[model samples]
Target: MTHTTKNDPVRAGLDRRGFLRRAGLLAGAGTVLPLLGAAAGPTASAAGTADGDPDQLFQAGEFAAAGRIYARQLHRDPGNAHAAGQLGYIDLLSNRFTRAEHLLGRAQRLAPDDMTVRRRLADCFVRQDLLARAAPLLPAAQAEQLASVDGTPYAVDGPQATRVPFLDVDPLPQVRGAVNGGAPATFVLDTGAMGLTLTTDAAQEAGLAPVSSTAVTINGRTVTTYLGVVRTLRLGEFELHNVPVSWTDGSIMAFPDGTVTAGTLGTALFYHFLTTIDYRGRALVLRRKTPAQQRAFRAEAARTALRPQPLWLAGDHLPCTPGMLGGYGPRVAVIDSGTLDCGLNTSAANAERAGIPVDWDHPIPVNGGTATVYPATAARMSIGAAVAHDVPGTVGPTPWEGLTGFDLLGNFTHDFFKPFAVTFDYTAMHLFVG
Candidate 1:
């Protein structure tokens, strides 16, 4: 079955009081109640009366309904840390960072020894760009809790992990391509990026000439970007020529740990093939599916659109525009791959001048520190041939003009091609497949 959080569409308007009453009865039946008290957050009442329905709602991804139940519980007993922590989580998911921070902080105070609360609180700091605050708590947070099982800090083990099946070419081939005539080098498969971006140093060494240039904004600042062409590019058993490349100083961050992998295979390559990233097997499989497989994949892809996008290492993009969230007019947003929800800038108007509905009745925590998020239903978004309506997103204050991250990409997964065989033809406005 497809698992979802309490925010599932089907359970939107559930009753609050009845849920809590049922939860209390369920807790009474379970012997695990006593053990849970010392675990974290709120202390069970003498009868251990808890309306477990809210907890069930949370587990089911009905975040809004779960929040309502938590609110009622908190109203009855303000000292309930469990309710507070859950409330914070709901807020965090909704992009309500400030409120989340406050509630999470309270939960931590109520249950000082609870590692889960601490870790969640730390994550909030990371989302808010307060990395320094999060660094201290990283050691205590379990890696599994940080992100999904397929996420980082874990690598595939065993012999099967060593091979990747996608490359029709040889797996470990050498290349004679250079950025500015410096030295022959090899690159690695990187499905995370949207385009082929080379480091400034690599472009300078390969003797590639700049074909054109433009400026794009990053972290609220504009930076110049260079487009160039490579005479020859090579991968395991594949090679191509006259390929386009983008050069940027930002590419340096790709090698933060300094492992000697040259260039990266980006989304430009993956779009051409049916790609599978098997994290457990430690291999990326890419194969040209048969016509039937293609048809099936396209059908499946339509449903995948609503799922959260993976926050890969590649940077994110958001279109630049003046848009309203929470009834506010024109606040800059950052298209954040790392973020699971949409957020509004703090200056956005809370009054509903546009038809947008600002969710003040249900405030959610953004992370777990001081921020809270207001939910909003986006009326429409226009992109190329795609139009999204009634999309649920968040409103928050950010330092960027706007973000074009996964919310814009919808459910499109990228394919990274071996050099030369694939190209992103911006001028032609099409992904040219070999």
Candidate 2:
């Protein structure tokens, strides 16, 4: 779901009051009544009928109607944590932050252990500019059931062991006049970056000319930098020319590994091809999609949307409100290769708290540190049609909305899904391929 402020006329097409009334009728008639006195609970038909209508409406992009149905359900069962969490989510989609917060807060109070509620509540804080409050909830959310790392519950297996198909490319070759004298170096594949970036040493070795220089911050503080254009870059079966590149002045040649990779691949690479990163399989796949494939991808994107999970404080174990990733709407997990761990904002943590098991034994290194840091364990991790067991993940601070990466990617044949379309459904917390 995406949110648009009242000032943004582009999203003001729906009538909130009318939609809410109709939703109330449908939810009461279809769901709440049937579950009132059943031994086994509501029948599948009842639940399906009740849930299906709003789901269909949501899928059809009827945001107003969907919001109303969800709202109605919440009114009927003010204590139904799931309904309340979802209602808060609706408020987020409509840019009703205050209302969303209110409903989400109520849901959390009703179900203090619900992770989904916490995730949403965290999002409310972020939207309201409460960064400090939002930061603490990330760890708990990342520790939920789905976020995985390595092949274990917390560590991600590298590409070498996964055998996922991938197109291999060396940024060095595309670099003009590169010295090519050093030993072969590896580079991290980063999707979160806005453009291509290389280490100062690599850029100098490649002999690329500096067009300009600036200061930028990474991981934390500000640093001096250089910007330039590459004459040509070749990777696998594709080639690009005169691409813009950025280089840091620091000696940080690569992630801590320093051997497995030397540079980073950013969003610049994805604009030209459909790309997939399989962390479990330790591979990156890239290919051009056909026109038909492109249409399917776009259609799936439109049909799927991300639900915001609540962010939790680092140590506090409690449910928060519900929310969704804002601008991206419906797509398989938004990739943020820049992020070090698979983190959930507060809302996701709340969702996980509600349904998934919590295992803290699994520990994984974050920020390339071996000591004094570890993430949580995930009970299940799935991407598209593939699923993995005992995934590991952690929570951390974020500047943007939400993202899915390493924790889930490590389990799949990353190379096999390249050039294919992928969509993530935050409501279902599932990934689908088109």
Candidate 3:
């Protein structure tokens, strides 16, 4: 497909939203890496082995252990900028915004030229609702993202706990919502995406006006994107106000019946609520993250025989967990809600390590490129007590390997955990499956 361009400010073509639909970047294919994958982002550097080095452990997705080592290093050598930065990164992943801000700020002062540290600090400021302080350090597009939500960030306007029944969508979950009082439109619950994104038609129907504009490079191809604010978004019994949104002037993905999804509800909205994608119950539940609510959830989980596993949020909104694929232990597993069709996706290096074969001669088209994808079965895949045997998945080269020099062993899709009710407790940094 040829890339499309547009002249209208609010109708830019092939932005991140369009890129996602075309490249399947969030579907574990890794055709084009995340926004964090640009020139020498935080996780792009490597130091040593996980045996004693914090950098290696951090790259290995062993965040807890890496934090301990980095803390010790920082204590012994107070000027250790790398140690401070790594600790800050860990805290950011764990959602300790204030602590992360302090550590990252210190790291930036020590190593002013480290673009990675500066980027992480900017992100920390944004997370703390200090957009003005972060805007200068961000790129044009991301800076515009903050500006869109400058005065009025996302806020809930109704009851604390709201339940929205999922519309009948296969593989991925969808719900009916309206933007700025426009007609109701369908939105997918895409944890793989960072923020809310709408199609051109949806934005136009809502009468959205562009507030910011910039160009972003995807797979070495530049695409123009515009930012706007969604004054109100109605979902079920609740509503969200002043949400930042980006859209493409062109159409997104088309279904078999010639229908198209309106938009996507990503992590940006879910971060404000204790989100639960109740697959078994056929609903999306959102609750305030209060201590009382946490206690109630713990009691309920105990009664339901659901085990809590550690989950960390990495670059942007990527939710990562520790899991095993085949015989490999402690591999980084991403719980990608955007991925459908397959249960798990593993890198070609990991497949070879697990003794899975690949037919390189037969390449399949992906993200406007050819990839040698092969099907294989893992003897067992486990995340905490939740384990599946004889799991079928795919193997191919992934951009993640090039980004971190670490092979990502598992990318778990929504269908893989469809039988359980999954809850992401960001406040507690835990994922519970029942």
Q: Pick the candidate with the highest TM-score.
A: 3
Off by over 4 Å in 1: 1-192, 220-222, 249-251, 254-256, 289-434
Q: Tens digit of lDDT per residue, candidate 2, span 293-405?
A: 44544464567542223221110111111212222122223333333323321123422542334344653332212122234444443333333344334432222221110
Best-matching candidate per lDDT: 3
lDDT of 3 by residue, 127-175 (tens): 5567788877765555665666746577778876888998854547888
Sliding window of 10 residues with minimal summed lDDT for model 3: 6-15
For candidate 1, what is the TM-score?
Answer: 0.31
Model 2 residue 148 CA deviation (Å) reads 41
Question: Cα RMSD for candidate 2?
Answer: 19.3
Q: Please list the Cα RMSD from the true structure of every candidate, rounded to 1 decimal place.
A: 22.9, 19.3, 5.2
The TM-score between candidate 2 and the true structure equals 0.41
TM of each candidate vs. truth: 0.31, 0.41, 0.86
Please give the distance, in angstroms, between residue 158's alpha carbon in candidate 3 and its true position after superposition: 1.2
lDDT of 2: 0.37
Give the per-residue lDDT digits (tens) of candidate 1, residues 1-434.
11111111111111111221111111010110001111222232212236556765654335577788888887898888888887876665444678989998998898887665665676566444354565455441112122211221111122221224332232222122333334655554433233345555676677655544444332223344455455555432333344445554444422222333345444434433444443223334444434654455445545644221212211111112223342333332222111222312232343244455667877664322234556666565322223345655554433221111112112111111122122222111122222
